[model samples]
Target: MSIENVKNVAVIGAGSMGHQIAMLSALGGFETVLQDINEKALEKAIDMLEQRMNDWVNKGKLSEEQRRLAFQKLRTTTEIKEAAQDADLVIEAVVEKLDVKREVFKLLDQYAPSHTILASNSSSIVNSKIATVTNRPEKILNMHFFFPPLVMDCVEVVKSEETSDESVQIAMDFCKKIGRTGVLLEKEIYGFIANRLLFALSNEAVYLYENGYADFKDIDLIAKKALGHPMGPFELMDLSGIDVGYYANMELYKETQDPKDRPAKCVEEKVKAGELGRKTGKGWYDYRKEVISR
Candidate 1:
């Protein structure tokens, strides 16, 4: 079915990106189900969405009635079958692991209607890797969203070799309907476009810092002042979570087997220490007190 006929969307995760994507789908007038196996996470996602929409109302970005309507469009569930059974589109934003994602798609194929389109919000893992586990590869594609889906306007719609033209078009149309600028990738590749470029830049930034050629603050400053970026590599990593980049790099490394694709030692150390950036209150720079102090 075309995006115009799609009435329900299922977002299969309640973590950082999934909940926001579900919110975006609901706000775009689709019945949205935000699903997770953890009951507490589903509860937290509902609470977070309420606070976020209320904040938007306070900021004049959304009317109180609009917020209420969006809330009405959303439902959270701990059951995967309940979320996917009737959904016209299912977006997986679970753990960034090939095996884990493949398993999710396998279940999605079992639960979702035959016409449902399955998309992944993976930053690195390509859709083809996960599609092989399912019978509906033509309906599987990557709809990669950047961190903080509400603020990021760009959405990468990646089509695998098995993905149908109609599925790609539907994914792009859905992105536009939800207020995001959709860029369709002609082919599927790890990291799509954004993460490939960002990860390469950040990998080098880590290299420079680890080698004592420059401090992270100096690197960030150079990237901001000289490169004309809104946020420097370190700051961006902190916001996106250091573990994210670390895992993405590892995934790429596994596919390419290129030592260069491996996570930088500095990033490895931070993830090992559990200093997962703003989420954890510490990362390349500590966020416990003030981010400005960095």
Candidate 2:
């Protein structure tokens, strides 16, 4: 089906990325549904979306009528079938695990209509691996959006060998409809474009920190002041969730069996300690006090 055929959109996660993505879809004038199994997560996502929209309205970035219309277009559900049954497109933004993504696709394939295109917002695992479980491999591709989708303007529309050219074009068109710049990748890769670049920088930063060459804070300061990076690798890790980086690295290691591809000991330890960054109120740096003060 063409981009014109896409009228209903389902976002199958309510976390940081999924909620913002659903908001963008709603703002783009599609019938959008945000689904998650956890009731609290769904509630939190709705609350966050409302607060963000209000902030945008206050800042004159969005009109009150636009906010109201977007809200009218968006809904929430806990059932996958309810979300996907009538959807013309499904974007899966679940955890960064291959098995979890495969399972999600299996359900989306079963519940979504035949014309519905399924996309994964994965940063590491390729869509081809997840498409193996679905019947519509040609409709499955990576629609990888950066973290904090509302602010990040770029999206990677990655196509696997099985992905049709029509599907790629449709994804690109949808990205434009939602106010994002879509970069089309004719071939699939492990981390797509941006993340692969990020992974290399992050890996080196972690190496320096782990080997006692410098502290993470110092590294971050140098990156920002010297290299002109807005946020250092360690700071980026905290914002993006250290667990995400850990899991992505582990996935790469699983495929290549390269010792260097494995997650650094410091990262693994942080994950083990349940310090998964800002969402958890702690990570490379503690945010608990900041949260409390706020």
Best by TM-score: 2
What lDDT is obtained when candidate 2 is compared to the true structure?
A: 0.94
Which residue pairs in candidate 2 collide?
none
What tens digits encode model 2's per-residue C-alpha lDDT throughout 41-70? Answer: 999999988988999999999999999999
Candidate 2 regions exceeding 4 Å error are: 291-294
Backbone atom clashes (below 3 Å) for every candidate = 0, 0
User: What TM-score do all the candidates reach, one by one?
Assistant: 0.97, 0.98
Query: Which digits, one per residue and each the tens of the lDDT, describe model 1 over residues 1-294?
Result: 788889999999999899999999999999999999999998988887888888889889999998999989999999999999999999999988888898989999999999999999999888889999899999999999988998889999999888999999999999989999999998877787988798788888988999999999999999999999998999999999999888888888888899988888878999999999988899988878874311
Task: Give candidate 1 regions above 4 Å deviation.
Answer: 291-294
Write down the lDDT that model 1 would get: 0.91
**Candidate 2 similarity to native, TM-score:** 0.98
Q: How high is the lDDT of residue 178 in model 2?
A: 97
